[model samples]
Target chain A: MKKGKAHVLKIFDNVNTDYIISGRYKFKIANMKDLAKYIFEDIEPGFYKKISKGDYIVAGENFGCGSSREQAPWAIKEAGISAVIAKSFARIFFRNAFNIGLCVVSCDTSSIKNGDVIKLDLKDELVINISRGERIKTMPIPQLMRKFLDDGGVIGHFKKYGDFKI
Target chain B: MGKTIAEKILSSHAGTELKAGDIAICKVDFCFGQDGTSSLIIDSFKKSGRKKVFSPSKFCMVIDHSAPSPNVGVSEIHKKMRDFARSEKVGLYDIGEGVCHVVIPERGHVRPGSLILGADSHTCTYGALNALSTGVGSTDLAMTLISGKNWFRVPESVKITVNGILRKGVYSKDVALRIIGDLGANGCTYNSVEFYGPVIRRLSVEARLTISNMAVEMGAKFGVMEADAKVAAYLNENAKINKGIEGVTADKDAKYVKIKGYDISSLEPLVAKPHAVDNVAPAMDLSSIRIDEAFIGTCTNGRLEDLKIVSEILKNRKIHKRVRCIIAPASKRIFSEAVKRGYIKTFIDAGCVVVSPGCGPCVGTHEGILANGEVAISSANRNFKGRMGNPDSFIYLASPATVCASALEGKISDPRNHIRV
Candidate 1:
């Protein structure tokens, strides 16, 4: 069982890749750390400075809806976001997050408030909202994805198994 | 128990019987990346310590986004792609070749019933030819590059059937925007959307490409159409492969999670408002919103057919003096064709700046970045905030005809009032 507490940073629906990291910095800055500084610069200015290493980003439905730019998830992970809790996620963003070892929790984030401290219990598939004393159910992570997360993403899995191991 | 097109394609590629929700490791027919995502793909490939791509002939790269190197950093990234292409013996389309989505099909890399992948979201454009194509992130693409295979959770299917003919001035883009508006942005997430009905049969290949191109905007995994004689002719004429023309189709009793219908005979020209692709409304209704720039190009509406419509409208008239109209052909082949057909000259005479064939001003890298508080209209797929560079600026999405008409009026206007389409 894996458990951790993190403060929530609330956002809205359909937060696209451009909002997470603008296309202007896509080619100009190759370093993930440098790009992290500009995460959510367009939608939420100075977003990187507000979060600590284990903070959670809670968003509405269809988060990360535009573009297949891995940089979007990379920036979020590089900014030290522990997990992104949302009602839903775009297909590519969901796959990319798992590929990069970013924790993406799908649940009803409507009850979660900004700056709320929430505990994620991965083994129980529950989001314990310590601030409000509520325990919400999360979509169970698939066995393959759980394995990918254990190995720190597809690259780590590949390095260990020499194949996708699908 | 019949299989949908996606299930059939994935099952064949995986060499096993499969269904929706089943995870299968399938062989990839073709895979590619663009400049924006190719750098990360290369880095991931290098980090994996993979000495060679799974199949050089089956893979390629395009330098369409931020092409011609906007700055030193981009130039270095292009150099890396070139170097990697040289060493790996994979095909590389440098600056001016065209957008990856357009260039790949014109170069015969796309075919029916094939499973294609790319690092760019609009890669679904090839689904017009009946291929199971979708976009992926850099790491997944790199994994495919190394192993020539990727896993997929077969997506449930959605059947969208359209009846009746599209009215004059109402192009495929309008129909697509209408459907996207109805479905919302996340309506089709993780689903294979199959387009059917009589209306699809009459649309030209380019028009169908326009529709499939925006499927990603609705979050569809694959937006495919049934291949027919037109697709066969296209493959024969362009791809030069005539024998394998019998493309796959869904089973007669194929299951679909949802079915929606549309009749476009009375559908008016549509536009997606700023900051959201699904915020669609009739183009004429938004005439009060003035525009500073008018762009007519991208993977969605940058074909010769689109340019012909723009030329017809802009032939004898100059655009509004205040509006900066930019036109870009989707590929070099389309560029030469437009030049031969005199569309380029008509555009130049109409005071439009015709740039080289590539994804210009679409990705907000260069060519036509918007200023803060400015407004622009384009024929591109997405109208997300800051999509054209400045977050404060606004963007509206429409068809090329609408964009051209709006260019003439310096505001969002209807194409029907400008010309008889």
Candidate 2:
């Protein structure tokens, strides 16, 4: 069970990895913290300065839609984003997020406003709009994925289990 | 209910009978990481405190993405990959070896009925040989490396039935593009696509590879065709015979989530327009659009047959002076075969820069990058913004024949107009 409160950074649908962090920066930046400075570089200039630790992102459908580059999720995780709540996600991005211990939830983003203070409760599968006194239901994270997130990530999960044998 | 091809493979690997939506933990027969993502996987694996891989023999490190590094940064990446491979004592394919997908099969690593995974999305290309293969993130790959197993939710199969033989000037690339046009980019997301029909069965293994290779464009989990006589013949020709190479077939009463049919008897050459793979328009519709560059290689269509067709089209003519044409075979083996068959000489004589066999220009790491405001027609899969270097540049996807014809005219032109067949 986990809960976090943060302000929402609103973005639109089909936000690709190239838009998250362009390919040019991929080889240029070695450290994850350095890579965070370039997240959403093209889509929102000066994004790193505007976003603080524990901030959440609210996006529309198909977020993280291009390339299986793990750096997409790595940059977001390093940027101090608590979780990303979207209507849906590209499969690769969705998998990458869980692997990196970054939280992602699918829900109706229509009622969530930019700059609104939101509380995410992973165990309860709810996104609370504390600013507007609203509570939106989120798609329940799958059991296996819940285990993955609880253990911190795939690597953490592996460390706990030693082997993935059933 | 009888299992589909994807289900059968998963069930066998899981050591239990399974159905769609069932979770199964299975041993990985082959797992690889390309240059772009291997460093991350290595980082996560080390962070997890796992000092050694589960099985060094089952793992490979392929350095195809940015091989012969373009800059110091990429060169460091290659160095890191080499150090990791040496320390881990795994198979390593260095530069000039070939694209990972192309070389893996050429080396007989992609036997039928095996489960394969890679850190690159096109890893699903192995499904062309009746294998259950899919792409994973770097962390997921790290998990697989340590545990020798990965979890999978058996995907519902979408059966695609094709009818009639394709005419000349229209190849497997056209068939794949046509499907993407109809299905759009996300139509088959998370679903397995199984190709079945007379035309599919008759297609050579290399041609079938082209079809399954592009399944990622339509968001398919795996694109598979049954291993048949043609596949057996090709495997035999390549001398890759092994007991593990037996074909796995789905039952006649297998259930499918959705079934779609396409007829290719009169299918025209097709091209995916700028910015999106599913933004497909016919070659005839785009005849007036001129290209600054034309690329004829990738894991998608860099086989010997593709090179042979390009040679056939460019035998007596040269490319338009305005267009810079580049040709790359998919692998070193394919390049050697093309050289022996005089195809490489034909390309060189026809004014095309025949680069070494690797993933050249596909990811814009090296060779044939487009400048701002430039337009390129290529045989690669995706055409998203910044996919081939400059964000402002445009990329068009087409079959090798269409790319060849366009290179000659400096515009998107139908291969039929140039080739009498």
Candidate 3:
């Protein structure tokens, strides 16, 4: 298991997933290893190859503002990134992140900037800046999402908590 | 102070007694979800610790917007939704069936007089049939899953009565774009829009859909029409549509917020300038803005009729060699019909890309997105930044006529003059 942490390299106001991953390659790549190759291939050039799992994405208002594509956050999690820190998320994106156990927090986006290394403790919703010794957040994960996080995504969550009535 | 139909519906379904500042928690009669958002919605269904769905099985999920799963991450999400729907015994789900909006109405879930809510903002597209539909966030949707209720500030009604016969080349999409541009994008926020008058009445049900589907662009909850004999006729013939449906009608003396009237009988094709749906002008007013693509599809105006309108226009003229033209039908049924009618041949003969149904270029995800510095005029909803492709790409909201004529000239030209002789 990886601790949620990452050093930010660039900050954006509202970074939609189409630019992060895109619908063009949706069918071309069918798994994490293959999909990761083109991550931000166009938008933030070199971002997909450079980012490691457990890194953090900080953004301004309405991050993930377009169509409700779960792949937006799914790609982030599978690419080894751990969490997203934003001022506020589009209503759908917030729940989608939690559905698959991705660590997402709403913080004052203006307080953070590029090159800030932060530690994310999912249990308490505490986002600790290792370098600046500052913290910011307000993510109260519902009991259900916690189960998904504990088991590691929906498949794990269901396998562990599923009711086999069928 | 005659009230619009939209006000009548919202007031009737308001659950409890409504007041000026009240944000009533209205019980939802319908809910829609798409593949782009369905997996997570289903996941939240399991995570909410809820045991079963509170809404009826008519609550649907459309596999539009990346239906084929643009990537592996998307595939996993789709699989999760399928497994959840099966395990939960959820009915009314579209498994790569078609675009959410097109499929929802095709399956007969939409009816005049019901207040429906979808996770996609464009959910209001159902208003074409005169239903009051709105879009909400997934969290609010989760609450709906648990309790079958959604909250909303009772919106004021904007009654727009049209008293003109549509010009031969003009379309319902052109009328909607003109209204949205005239009213400004946020002009109708938290408001209900009711289309009435002879023009609205005369529009074919498909044409009415073209108008109502773009309600979101005006920041409205819905663009609805009264459930008249025409609607009843449509429902009766559309296979098994939502039956036993009750309709919402205006109180004889219902209070109104605004009563705007238009005589668009002489109106020309319209366009919404870049970054704003309200920055509109007649297509004839601007001819210099060249385009790279002309798109006519999506839930807004992607039905067979909309296609026929375009094919009739494109059949006479060749597409500009410098520009690309794309028309994505809203459903497989529409696709098959167009093929049977030789409509697809007309489009292909004119050098247009006829994509399979599912939200293609309209959403900037697939189909015909514009590149940087490129411009496009579409019949689809939304002209938001980077909505079509590159953030640098400029998207103008327009009617199907504008899209077709523009495709022929490689510029945003006037479709009114291009009327087939």
Candidate 4:
């Protein structure tokens, strides 16, 4: 069971992977940490300076919709984002986040406004908006994904066990 | 209850009876990675403590994205890929070979009823040959490289049927954009979409590839079409594989989560507006939108047929002086074919620049990057913000015919006005 206050940084719908990290920087910077500085640079300039470590990014539907570039998730995680809460996530981005151990929660994020502090309970699959005094339910994480997160991503799981336990 | 094509393929690959929503570990028939994702794939493969690829022959590495080294940083990555490919003795498609999606299928690596995976999202393009193919992350691809297998959750199926003959100048790219517009960005999230009907059967294999390549835009896991005589003939003529020519099809009573139909007889050329692939409108409606560039290339519309269409439109006329028209064939084979057909000469006569066979500007790495406040009419997939390197610039998606027509008019124009029915 884990619970914490997540500071919200809101964005609009259909935020594609290209906006998260521009394709120009994908091969230009091989290091994930260096790539983190350009997160949301295209859509939201200076986005890297707006948030602190452990902050949560709340967005509308269809988040990370374009490109299977894993650098998008890597940059977001390296930028110190704790999780990405949205109404829904694109298929490839959803899978990539889990593979990298980045938390992606799906729920009704309409009522949660920007800059609101929300309480996220991972075990309960609940998001309590402390500012709005509202409770929202998120889709349950699959058992295998939960295990992957517990092991700190697929790489860590591979290190712990020679092969995937699946 | 009958099973869909996806279920049939996955169950056979898994060696067990599996249904939609079931998670199973299945053997991959073929897997690949490109320069954009291979670095991470290599890192993960090494970190996993694997010494050799599970099946070096079954795996391949391609250097299409950022090919020929656009910068020093990218050059180092290309060198790394070359070194790794040599060390592992795995197959590698060097720069100028073409985009992975186009080269792999052209070289006969794809077959019907086979399960394939690649590190690039457009990997679903192989599904046009009736294979079960989808994209994966670097780590997932790395795991497949080490184990020769991966896990999957069989996705529910969506049946999209298109009937009636398409109108003149409305190519498969227009059909794809129309369907994607109707489905929205995440309409089929995590679902496998199967295209059917007479229109699909009549389309050439290259046209089908265009439709399947954009399936990822609608959030579909796999976009597949039924294998027919055309696919068999293509494989026989290209790869010489005669066995397993008859591919799998959905059962008569197969279940589908959704069924949608479109009559393309009345369809007109369409274009997806700036920043979103689903923000589609008629080409003529956006004629006022001026452009700085007109690009015709990428896995979506860089084949010989597409180049021929552009050449036919630009045969006796020079493009607008204000527009920079660029054309690239999807592969070196297509390049030579275009040259032999005199299409390359026609493009040059029309003042269009022809680059090498590869993903030139589609990925925003090289060839043509839009400047600030510039607008481009392109035949490539995805018009996401900053997709062509300049966030302040705009990109509109259309067919090669429409792209050529707009290059002549210096703005978005209807292809019907430029071509004869």
| TM-score for each predicted model, relative to the true structure | 0.98, 0.95, 0.73, 0.98
Give the best candidate by TM-score. 1
TM-score of 4: 0.98
> In model 3, which regions exceed 4 Å deviation?
A1-166, B1-15, B92-96, B241-246
DockQ value of candidate 2: 0.57
Model 1 ranges off by over 4 Å = A1-11
Best by DockQ: 1
Q: Encode model 1's per-residue lDDT on A24-68: one tens digit a residue.
A: 888789999999999988887887888788778888888888999
Sort by lDDT, best first: 1, 4, 2, 3
Q: What is the C-alpha lDDT of each candidate?
A: 0.91, 0.86, 0.70, 0.90
Q: Tens digit of lDDT per residue, candidate 3, span B170-279?
A: 77877887787777655565567878899988888888887777776665666777777677777777745646555566666766567788899888788888766667
Q: For each candidate, what's the DockQ?
A: 0.87, 0.57, 0.10, 0.76
Tell me the lDDT of model 4 at B327. 90
Clashing residue pairs for model 4: none
Order the candidates by TM-score, highest first: 1, 4, 2, 3
lDDT of each residue in B166-273, candidate 4, tens digit only: 878999999999999999988888899999999899999999999999999999999999999999988887678889878999999999999999999999999999
Per-residue error at B149 for model 4, in Å? 1.0
Question: Order the candidates by DockQ, highest first — what do you get?
Answer: 1, 4, 2, 3
**Candidate 2, TM-score of its B chain:** 0.98
Please give, for residues B161-246, the per-residue lDDT of candidate 2 as tens digits.
99998987889899999998998777788889999898887787888999999998888889988887777766666656656667
Model 1 clash pairs?
Answer: none
